[model samples]
Target: MTPPLALYIHLPWCRRKCPYCDFNSYPAPAAIPEARYLAALFADLDADCAFLINHRPLSPLQSIFIGGGTPNLFSPAAIAQLLNGIRQRLPCSAAIEITLEMNPGASVMAQLPAYLAAGVTRLSFGGQSFSIRSLKQLGRIHRPRHVLAAVRAAQAAGCRQINVDLMYGLPLQTLAAARADVERLLDLSPSHVSYYQLTLEPNTPFAQSPPPLPAADVSADMGEQGQQLLAAAGLQRYEISAYSRKEAQCRHNLNYWTFGDYLGIGAGAHGKLSTVSGGQVARVIRLAKWPQPTAYLAAHQSGHSQIAHQRELSAADLTLEFALNALRLTAGVDVTLFQQRTGLAAEHLSAARAGAQAAGLLDGGAAGRLVATARGLECLNDLLQHFDLS
Candidate 1:
């Protein structure tokens, strides 16, 4: 069976790219080329839809995530036009979740209602931290009060679904400060919270001029204690860094964790698609757009493919890819999904599964769900070493 489908639209222009950021984002010009970028997105989407006809099948979209340099930088009218254009090009579910990511800047607060009116059902604020010192250390533009004010504005606008992102283990951060961040976020009662640690990704400014961060053991303690705080606040830990109320788990991200299918459109967007072959074998294909916004737009205007990268997953590649995502879930995945999503033979992954289970990093057994133990979750990279042949 085909996995559920989702859509991810990347808007890659930010007012100023964050120093700690490594996403394919660039600083914006005085005026963003919204109309031109949108045209390119539709062209990319059209090509993807055509590929679906030959190698993929059209499935009504389950969710749409508008991520960005800063999606809220665009006006409500532009967002409305984009969403309407997408619906005309693809069939979306009646209850489809439409999420738009926004910075906690004061300017975006006034735009919340207009966004909701334009069909954005959920608003995810990049509130990173609540401490003034930590925000400055992370080079965030918004002050602590802006985060509180943004959530309040969302509530006042009658937007029901909200997600707030918070980072732990910052430069000079103490465990108490991390707890305070969680406590303040819980006060907002966001439906979902992405409580993640700030790691120095390669090629980023942070990686080059690494700051004096908390000690490794202290960071570990910060994560463990922070999890306890969120769990006690009625936010269940679904994935390692994600928590949500009983039914507020992010459906779009859940699809990714489960290795479901999704279409990626826009500069620097990536997508995965699945198809079954020989009535039993599953084959997966991945596609990515040009990372440079100008290059991508030029390719579209010139009628070029605009795909900077593309590949088909080998069996071993599929095994690792599936495990990488599925194991992030606290509850793990249905063992049967390996074959369904990857279209590979069971033996391809059984030995690796047995090895992890024998090491006590994994729970359950050969017949039921595959789960990661608490210790396994803590040492996820080490646990993955068991499955990584390369």
Candidate 2:
């Protein structure tokens, strides 16, 4: 069977990087080298295609994700050119899920129609918070009203599959405050909701000067209450931080959680692919593109990006990778899928199972899947520790 192919397009520039964000994002400059970047992006994709043409002749493109710093920063023409490049090099399926990530800031508002017409079927808005205070605290450029306006504009542009990202347990947040934010977002009736707890990641400004965030107990309460509210709002908590209306869960992410294959194309993007030959030889692969956007552009212009940074995964690597991503879902991957995806005996991770179960972090039998117990989801770090490389 031909491996499923997915493309990740990364635009590494944002209007302004948020204090809490450590993503591969940079502050946008006054003049963007759109034409140069577009040329380089296509060249990079062409190089990736040549690899497949030589070794693994895939059938057609299954999915395409235009994530960013902010894909909306580019004009529809640039996006179309990139899409056309993919179409020219490979067969693009009609059912391909083309998703674009947009920030709610006013600057991106005008590109909605062009994006929709450019074949972007899904739009995920970075509506980090509906609370104006939270927006200010997070240093978001857009206000709650702008988020509302963006959602309306996307709907008007004929985007039915919309995802609004929200955050809870923010600085000085309360359960009541968190509930109100969810209510406001739900009023927009989006197909998907991704609710993430605020984490002070290392290297982020938030980590350098830690804000007065809610306490652990308060953060937990906010998370629990937010899940309950989202469920009541007709969005099922399909994963720890993701919820969706029926058939609306993000397939691109689901592919990752289930260990499906994809090609990482842009700066800082990562991908995985699994291949089994005969009954003895199996390879579960991983790949990372270059991290610096400016460097990527330079490499793109040179006709060779050396773009792929890492591309190896041993059996144990696959096991850990599978568990790390799959266990994040509320409904975990099937037990059989563990062996199929990782090419390892599930019993190899028996210690993880026993440890998590003892810690009340895993349900002994949920769909006969190694799913996260409420406690398991909460103590994820501890649970994942059971899979240490040592």
Candidate 3:
């Protein structure tokens, strides 16, 4: 049997491009072309469904993650249309998790009720910080009050699963300021929190002219202190950057961590799927759509495949890819999961596992669990080197 499946939809329009973001998002125009985008997305979904029918039938979708360039820019009607179209094309559980990402502000809060009514089960806000200066430095347009109001609006709309995103290690950040952000986020009483450290990703404005952020040790301290604060508030760390209350983990991301298959739709979405033939794993395919919205739309209108890239994972590739995502979980995955997901024998990891064990990077040695030591989690890139074949 195939692993669990999920669906990912990308909306690549934001009100304004942040200085530090590296996602495939563009600034919104005065009026977004919602109808055209909706049509294209539906067409894309139809094509993928047809393709799946010829290859392998999918299991019920476990979750749907509508991520973006601030997906809140779309009207609730458009979202409803999108979700309805998906259910018509693909089979999914009635209780499948549906998450929408948005920036916290008054502009979008008024529509939260309609959005919840449209089938969004979870709301993830880009509540980057609570400090006025931090918001300005991070190039976020929403005020701190806006974050509070957004959460309140979601709750008033009867949204039960709310996630607040927080960040540490800002340019010239102090330990106290970082703690304040965590405190304010916990005060919102969200079901989940994504606490991240600011990094100057390559090709972003921050990378070209990097700001003076907290030093390495200070940034480490900031993360450590923030996790302690979150645990105290009953939101323990789950994934590397994710903390959540009991039974409230983001199911869509959990699918990714467990190396499950998923379909991708809309601009710049990526997907991984395993094809089975004769009751055996035949091949695992990775596919990505064109990143540019204009180009993607034109390709769709012309009835062309908008996929910009596709590749099959080699045995070595599968070994590393599985470890890359699974090791991110604090508790790790069962040792047998490597073979279950990749179709290769679990022993493919034996040599690399020995190397990691000798280096004190992997714990639960030679057992059912494949956990990373605290030091291994800190130097995850280094730990991944053991799995690297090229």
Candidate 4:
């Protein structure tokens, strides 16, 4: 059986890049070419669909995620046009979950209703933090009030599932300050909360001139405190950085963690699909579009290839990739999925699992499932390193 499919649409323009962000996002121009960009997106999607048609059957879309610099930067009408075009061209599930990422600074209050009407069932706000000092230090444009206003607007527009992104480790964040931020976010009554630690990613400004972050132990305490606070508020930790009320988990991300297939359209987007080659050997293919908007648009407009990169995963590559995503979940995946998604025998992971379990990192119970111990979750990178097939 073909795996469930999801769609990821990237919008590469942000008003400003954050100091710690290394995503493929650039500053927006005074006037965004919405029409031309939309046309390029559809063309890119069409090419991918055609390729799949010749190679493998396309699965019905289980979810759609419009992510990026800030998807809310586009006008509601532009967003509506894009979604409608996608629906016209793709076979989507009846209960498909559509999500749009919005920034509080982008006057999103006025666009919430239009987004909801455009079939966007979920809204993920990039609030980052509720502390003014932290926001400024992080080079965010929005104030704390803007976050509250945006959430209220989304709620008023009848959006039932909302997510607020929060970060715990800041340049000068105190334990109390981190707790306060979580409390403020909980007060908004968001269905989902993505609380993550701030890491100084390479190639970003923060890495060059490292900020004075809290000590390692202090940062760990902050994370623990935030998790406990959210737990008390009835939000369960579904993933390393994600907490949500019952049935409010982000399906788009869940699809990714479980190794489901997805088609990605837009500049710098990545996609994965599983297919059978040689009539019997199962293979997984990875596709990526051009990283720059101009190049991507030009390729599509000139009827040239939009793909910047494409590769079929080797057995070793597939094994490593599968473990990299699956082990991040608090509730690990069924062991059967290892073969189903990677086209490898279950024995492929036996040695790695045994080593991890012996080291007290992975749980030894759940004979048919792969579950991570609390130690495994904390030292995820170390646990995953043992799975290296090279």
The lDDT leader among the candidates is 4
The TM-score that candidate 2 achieves is: 0.94
Order the candidates by lDDT, highest first — what do you get? 4, 3, 1, 2
89: Cα error in model 4, Å: 1.2
User: Model 3: what TM-score?
Assistant: 0.98
lDDT of 2: 0.82
How well does candidate 4 match the true structure in TM-score terms? 0.98
Put down candidate 2 lDDT per residue, 1-390, tens digits, no spaces. Answer: 334678888888988899999899899899878887777777777776776554454667778999989888888988888888788888988899999999886766688888888889999999989888999999998999999999998888789999999999898888899989999999999999999999999999999999999889888888888888889989998887999999999988887777767777777877665554553226665767778878787777666754657567865676677778888998887787777666677787788787778878878867558798877787788778776554
Candidate 1, residues 83-143: lDDT per residue as tens digits?
9999999999999999999988879887888999999999999999999998888888899
Query: What TM-score do all the candidates reach, one by one?
Result: 0.97, 0.94, 0.98, 0.98
Q: Across residues 52-138, which tens digit of lDDT does each residue of candidate 3 receive? A: 666565789899999999999999999999999899888889889999998988887789988988899999999999999988988
- In candidate 1, clashing pairs total 1
Question: What lDDT score is found at residue 13 in candidate 3?
Answer: 98
**Which regions of candidate 1 are displaced past 4 Å?**
277-281, 364-366
Candidate 1 Cα deviation (angstroms), residue 36: 0.3
lDDT of each prediction vs. the true structure?
0.89, 0.82, 0.90, 0.91
Q: List the residue pairs that clash in candidate 4.
A: none
Tens digit of lDDT per residue, candidate 4, span 1-390? 467789999999999999999999989999988999999999998888887776667668999999998898898899999999998888999999999999996468887898899899999999999989999999999999999999999999999999999998899999999999999999999999999999999999999999999999999999999999999999999899999999999999999999988899999999998885543328899999999999999998889998999999998898889988999899999998888787789999999999989988889986888888999999998888778887
Instruction: List ranges where model 3 is wrong by over 4 Å.
Output: none
The C-alpha local distance difference test score for the whole of candidate 1 amounts to 0.89
